[model samples]
Target chain A: MTTLTREFTKGLWDEIPLFRIVLGLCPALAVTTTMENGLGMGVAATFVLVCSNGLISLLRNVIPSEVRVACYIVIIAAFVVAVEMLMKAYFFSLSESLGIFIPLIVVNCIILGRAEAFARKNGVLASLADGLGMGLGFTLALTVLATLRELLGAGTLGLVFGERVLLAQPFGFFQQAPGAFVALGILLGLMNVLSKSGK
Target chain B: MKSYLQMVLSLSLIAVLSGLALGGLNELTFEQIQINILKFKKIPAVADIYEILTGELSSEERMAVEEGLLSEKRYVDLGLNEPSLFFVVRKDGAPFAVALEDYGQGFAGNLGVMVGFEIETGNLVGIGITTMSETPGVGTRVKEKAFVTQFMGMSKDAVLKVKKDGGEVDALSGATVSSRAVAQAMDNARAFYTEHREAILDAVNETPGGSS
Candidate 1:
């Protein structure tokens, strides 16, 4: 449906979770250390987002208005727990590396924000499209930041998952905390530039 | 009125479903999680120290050295189980040394340190830091590979003091508290070894077969 397409496409640019809406930042900053970690976290978050959004929308008519927030939280927390457990079982090393961040997903504002703002008012099918769009948008933002950081910091790209595509031989500072700030600042600046030019 | 009751009932049902789904997943994955935690905990301090001593340890030696690192039990025998540390000494797949990790109340909190000695020679083989939560860029310098490397081959009589105190070890810059903590931890390890020298030697003689 045209309505479904609009809802989904809006999340990709106009209502982007990180650059535009500016939600779900804790994991954004913490897990953007490596491209693999960023992608892993993004996908995990997306899975929760899509599931919670669809489920919440389906139950929107049933959930009492007074207790909607609590209901949404319970729904989001359940998805987070499921993701955390799955990661631990299959991707033990990554699960350990991500550490406390996985549990912290329960508190990520993006899932709850969509549930309340969009899913509560929208039909289940439309809500699913929005969830998918926002989730992809979040993943894209995280991946871009992480790629910039990892390439600059470690002097190598794709070093995650035993792959290497060298960009620069050595950029040691990129691997440090200060480098994280620098990369993020540049990305934000570039996003602003692109948006202004488009407008 | 009927619609309100239906809404409440539906929300309750959704909550129950979510709970059951998550509980079932957790139950399924609990064993794998436990195994991962156990492996993480068992990674021995000796392996880390050996890598420094030999520079790039063979995987087999690494495993052997880890096996040699006694678990917390040996410290229990010394009544030091309150906060115990264990070290295993290995020579060609046989454990010939036992090191104990100890923590001394330092400037910020507990300082984690390891001391290793050759059972036959009573010669201190190595000392290292495993973990510490001192002030970053300051107290953390104590755990620097350079700072810890100083403990190699030092005899029991070698006073483990910062150079400012007229001893052999250099105190970490701006982290005298952490430095002192390491020195004290070493001293405690020394005292424990001296008191239990016979048992330690006996355990070392048992070598590869001994329970670490």
Candidate 2:
């Protein structure tokens, strides 16, 4: 149980997916145009991470050593396809909004990375805990970045559910490509500063 | 001999298991995937045109239009589904004019747009964006209702240039490429309408002509 706690907490900050490890960047940049998309992507990725990790851990001993990587890929791909199909059926608008990014989650390094580094070695319980923690960490990071971008770019927050808080006149540049880079850069800098300050 | 046999048996077993898992999942999701595809084909623009032209399209016509949207053969011939764009065109009740749209490749990704034009007069009745994937705050200004609304009633031959080029259109403040891409897509739709006017009209004029 103590180990489980450690595994989950580590992903939140100490080994943050986007800031510390910088995994799964394609969707990070592509679908994060709006706060809603960012949140949706984060949740979807988290679901894939938890399910794949748990399944992989269960089959760790069963999978042959020689073809473990291939097996892991198939498992991850299956989960991605499942998620994509489900999203399309139930959340058509979001599925459409996220577009190709949902299918592209198969290529996201974070899922494969966790499967290789943790799930393949850990027990089922430990792997589940790790998956949940890391997935949440990734989601949190994406949400922060997305919120900053959306708030500055559109001059509104919570545009997804139509809960808009008009903070200030939108700074148009914040919504451009350069804005994405700037936002990410400042976030990285801030994270580093906070970490160094022992917070 | 024993070790070699063990290796072969294990490999085959794994293969069989993996195959069964994947095949089962595929079978289960096949129907859902088909449904999603059908739903995608019935996006608002296509539905609107189909409704206007035929009062209410039967499920069969809808299925036809859905198939048409998914079919590569016709889209490739019309250049409507380029790597840069995906388009759908439908005629109104008179069958003399058709509304066409192109989803052009913008700076970041795709931009979906719709335009209605008269096949006979070559006049554009309306133009609007159904979707876009441009930079926020900057490129997304193209999606603004005001910006899209301006393209209404413009003549097909009217030079749809940005005001920077001494044309009537106003470019998005920080999204020149995206703005230009939208304009160019409209131009392509106009050219496509002109080039295929007679055939499109005839197709619309035929019984069961409307999109589903």
Candidate 3:
């Protein structure tokens, strides 16, 4: 794969934001009770991540090294607010579903981590791909987690493609805080097993 | 000295540019956002409350009120943290019912509650949970009909408290924070109205299109 494609694909698995890097667990644990919610949160974070990443990378040189982190936060927060307004106006339902976490995206370490580690050094195009990759990775991990939780917790998996209810009556333990912890533990174990086999 | 000047100038320049961008975006969407919140979240609660407040009004009048048969929606600022919105449905030039937006500090975070109230009497007609960060299935169950419905027709004269601390409001099992947060919201709704009853009424009544 070309280096550019590699930047985009790495987030799919290798440096997956939630699992591989273990970043942005707060929203993952909080909003992933349902597949739809997980997707909404994931996509919202991705929008902020991509836009903020591109902006920071473009302005990286203009920002002083000592105040780079503060500049990143301001830029990220502005984008988050803009995203929040747009969501509230147009995607009202999704905005309601995501709730406080939309604003909390300002605090999501994934966005900041990218700005500090990758965006600051890379060109805008490369940083955009990285942001898109990592954001999608986070989204994938969340959706997988939410799918399990919803199937188990609510006894129905309402996939957003016309909300086809996959299972009418599934396990209920996968829906709460304790359920989130247990589910994460199992998924991490599964990841460990898959990685061991590949090795 | 040169490095410090660079740091100060660069960060401020970034802040100013980003602020402009954010401001432009906010200008585009903030109006629509307000409309969305009003039409979806707050209006439903008002309609529900209007049902109970209906005395001698015809079904036509009831439907009109439910369909936001009002001329204007008033936003009130107690000048504290942020302004809370109030919707007063007037009939025949008299205030029929009032919906007060209330905020409470939840265990997880802040809670946004819109409460429908009877104007003449302080009875709670209905409620809408606008925003909450309570844990799903556990604390969030407070938003369900089983819990919020219990407050309907509740006399605002009484203090809103959870059963755990010796009030009539039943606390959700293992979700004390969520329950208390709701109670706090109710307390805010009642206190704000009681303290500023005249001003709230005056503001809405003073506005045009509210005459009988």
Candidate 4:
């Protein structure tokens, strides 16, 4: 139980993805234009990570080392397709907004990284806890980035906060591709400073 | 040899299981996904046609119109089992025009357009872009009023191609491909409306608020 707790808590800060591990910057940069988009993408990815991690851990013993990557990819793809279909069916608006990124989750390094580095050697419960923690941490990082971008880029807080505009003249630069890098870079610097202070 | 066989067997088994699960899920969600596309994509385009025909709709009015249109779904039989659905737009409580969806090969994929035709004269009421994967701010400008409004009140017999192709329509400055695609969809609408004029008329007449 302590092991499980340790595995879970590490993802929250110590090994938090994007900010710390830096596994999925592609989506982290692309979908963080709005808080709603970021949250939606994070939740979708989390679903895939948890499912794939648990499944991979369960089959870890049976899967031959030679064919494990192929097996993991197939499992991950199946869950991604399931997420795509479910999102389209129920969360149609969000599905439209997230667009191609949902399917692209199949190739996200974060899910594959956890499967290869952690889940394969771990127990199923521990893998699940690790996946949950990593997923939530990713969600947190994406939401914070998106809030900064949306607040400055579009001047609105998005659907969660009734899309109220907080800026008199929001800088449009923060909404574009280069802005994602700038915001991420600044946040990463802040994270490093805080971590060093804690140490 | 035994190890090789185990690898082959396990990989095949995983693939088969994943295939079965995804196939089942696809079957379950196919219908709902189609409905969602119609609601979110097709209906809003129809509402755009409504806005053009009458006037700008306030948010409340647009919502009410969309709700009414959803409940007023009508279909024209095109030898398909499910039949093709179309929306009728009313002006002054009378069925003034009918809107149907058609598609053209766009730069990225199929570009869907909801085309409105005047019922009395068969002239075009206007067009609305339904679904597009064109480049944002470039090719996507084909959906803008400046581009689409050119089709409004055009005669059915007029050639529906961009000026580069010897037609009257002017293409967007930097997005000739997407502009041509919208023209292609307009041409398709003309052909479809001509081919199924009788059936479409009958369907509209049968509608509760439609006229003979």
Candidate 5:
């Protein structure tokens, strides 16, 4: 595989953010109560991640090492704020639902982690691919978890998609914080088993 | 010393560039963002007031009323450079009440309240919280029906201060600052309504389509 494809695909499976790397659990747990919220957050984060990654990679040589973290934060915050303004302008309801988490994206460890561990050392194109891959991976994990929780907790699918009621009664536990932890734990265990069996 | 200079120079350059980009983006989206906030936040709050004044409305009717309210924007120039925006609430194809927003300092920052006032009687129709960053369970209770219903039907000249300040308004338990913020916003609203009553009524009446 080419370097770009390798970097991109790795985020899909090998380093699938929340599940494998265990980063960005805050938003993952907070916004995954519903499928729509998870998806909305995922798209917003992807925008920020891609933009920040590309910019950081392009400026890696110019940014002094001693102040790289600060520079990265400035870039990430600008993108996050831009996302916020755009979301409010166009996707008002979704922006309302996501609330502070959209602004809090500036602090999401996933973006900073990638900037330090990958983008700072990689070329701009490679960093862009990596960001897109990681972002999509994060989106995938959030969607899967949110689908499970929403199905079990609400007995229906997303309201955005015209909620389809599946179960007559749903377990309400999966909609709360404790449930998020338990569900994440089980998913992690499941991933472990799958990885083991694959080998 | 050379490396230090580079660090400062680079950091400052990045910060300045980021600020410029954000400022420009904010300018570009400022109008749209305002419309969105009015649609999503202020409109809903006014709808809450509508529900309180006139009985409940079906979802379709509520949507119609919200749409009408958006088009009903009237400006009152309080000598504040730019004319302040307020909305008219129509009843039975006539101007019934006017809704305007005001803000007060809260625990976190500014808490916005949209208040409705009856045109003829000069009585407060109701109040709905437009925006607040108060504590979720405690300060946020100010948005609850129990807390807000207290302001319903209050006369225009009534003292809009909390009981803590020797006024009739009751403060929310465990959230004095937020409760005070609501009272303060109401005071500001009352002042605006009373001062610009003629201008507001004239603006609403002059408009062609008051029916929705």
Candidate 6:
């Protein structure tokens, strides 16, 4: 049980998908322009990740070694399509805002990465914990990154809830595509500095 | 030899099951998704045009929207389902502005845009950009109100070319190609409106999905 707990918690910080391990940078950069966008993306990816990881782990022994990759991809893709439908049905506005990135979640490295590295070798419960932990970590990282960008870039935060109002002066430059990169770079650099100093 | 066959059988089984699962889920969610899309994307876009046309949309118009009677959407059945889709906004049983979505060639690739125009008045109502692949700051800024606002209230006979091209419209500073692409899309939509004005008006006045 301790080992299972360790497996899950490690994904939160030690093996964080974005800053520490540096997996799935495409949606990380594209959708972090707004807090809502980043959160929506993180949630969607999490859904696909958790579902795929669980299914792959359950079928790990049954799946042929030679054709496991193809099998995993099929399973992952079906879950992604399911996630897409649920999001479309319930959170239609969010689905629209995320746009092509929703379908693009199927190609996100984190889902496939966990499926290969952890899920295939782990038990179902362990895989589920790992997927949840990694997903939460991704969501946390995105929400933190988006808070910085939205607050600094646009001057007003809490626009995600739709009760928008101006609070402070904005840099405006942070709201652009270049701004997204610069902010991400700074965050990455900060994480590096903190880890190195701690070590 | 046995392992190879097992690999093939297992993979094929997974693929077949995935297909069935997806097919079943799609059936369950298709209607809700369609309704959500109309409520979220299409209605909001149509409402924006409606407000722009009449300055303010009435409570009746809002109710019409809720009742699914405020607008009509048409995908031009050109046999192959071309990128030509349109939304017709009606008031008092008459079509005010018909919004058309069309594509035009730009420097990057195809530039997709939507333009709403007053049918009877021959006045351009508004332009809202939908899908675009232009450069981020330069070309994509065509979506910004500064560039898009230039298209409002222009007449049908008025030349749609940019200022350098000897017309009223001003090209986006560094993204002239993107601006020109939007202009060309508007031109195409206008041409389509001219050709299919009668059919579109009839469709807007009819119930939803009752028109071609």
Top candidate when judged by lDDT against the true structure: 4
Better of 1 and 3 by TM-score: 3
Q: Which candidate model has the greater lDDT, 4 or 6?
A: 4
Clashing pairs in 3: A152-A171, A155-A170, B92-B212, B93-B212
Q: B1-212, model 1: which lDDT tens digit per residue?
A: 88778668767876899889888998999887755543344344556666655677788887765554434224324455442335555566656667776677787667767788777777777776755666545787886677877787788688877788878878878888889889988888888788878765554443232322
Measured against the true structure, the TM-scores of the candidates, in listed sequence, are 0.71, 0.72, 0.79, 0.85, 0.78, 0.86
Question: lDDT for every model?
Answer: 0.76, 0.73, 0.81, 0.89, 0.89, 0.79
What docking grade applies to model 5?
A: medium
Top candidate when judged by TM-score against the true structure: 6
Error of 3 at B96 (Å): 3.0
Computed on C-alphas against the true complex, the DockQ of each candidate is 0.52, 0.23, 0.73, 0.76, 0.70, 0.86
- Candidate 5 runs further than 4 Å off: B51-62, B75-85, B101-113, B124-212
State the displacement of the C-alpha of residue A160, model 5, in Å, after optimal TM-score superposition: 5.7
Model 4: how far is A122 from its true place, Å? 0.7
Model 2 chain A is weakest, by summed lDDT over 10 consecutive residues, at A158-167
Q: How accurate is candidate 1 locally (lDDT)?
A: 0.76
lDDT accuracy of residue A33 in candidate 3: 83
Query: Tens digits of per-residue lDDT for model 2 on B1-212?
Result: 76656556665665566567767877777676655644563344544444444555788886676566443112222445531222335453234345666667788777766667755687876665666767645687886656766775677778877778766677887788888878877877777677876655545434332223
| Model 3, docking class | medium
Angstrom error of the Cα, residue A167, model 2: value is: 3.0
Better of 2 and 5 by lDDT: 5
Highest DockQ, which number? 6
**Native contacts matched by each model:** 0.60, 0.16, 0.86, 0.84, 0.91, 0.91
Worst 10 residues of 6 chain B by lDDT: B75-84
lDDT per residue for candidate 6 within B110-193, as digits (tens), equals: 886677878778678887766566765679888786887677788888787777788777888898888888888888888878
| Candidate 1 local lDDT, residue B53 | 57
The positional error of residue A148 in candidate 3, measured at the CA in angstroms, is: 1.6
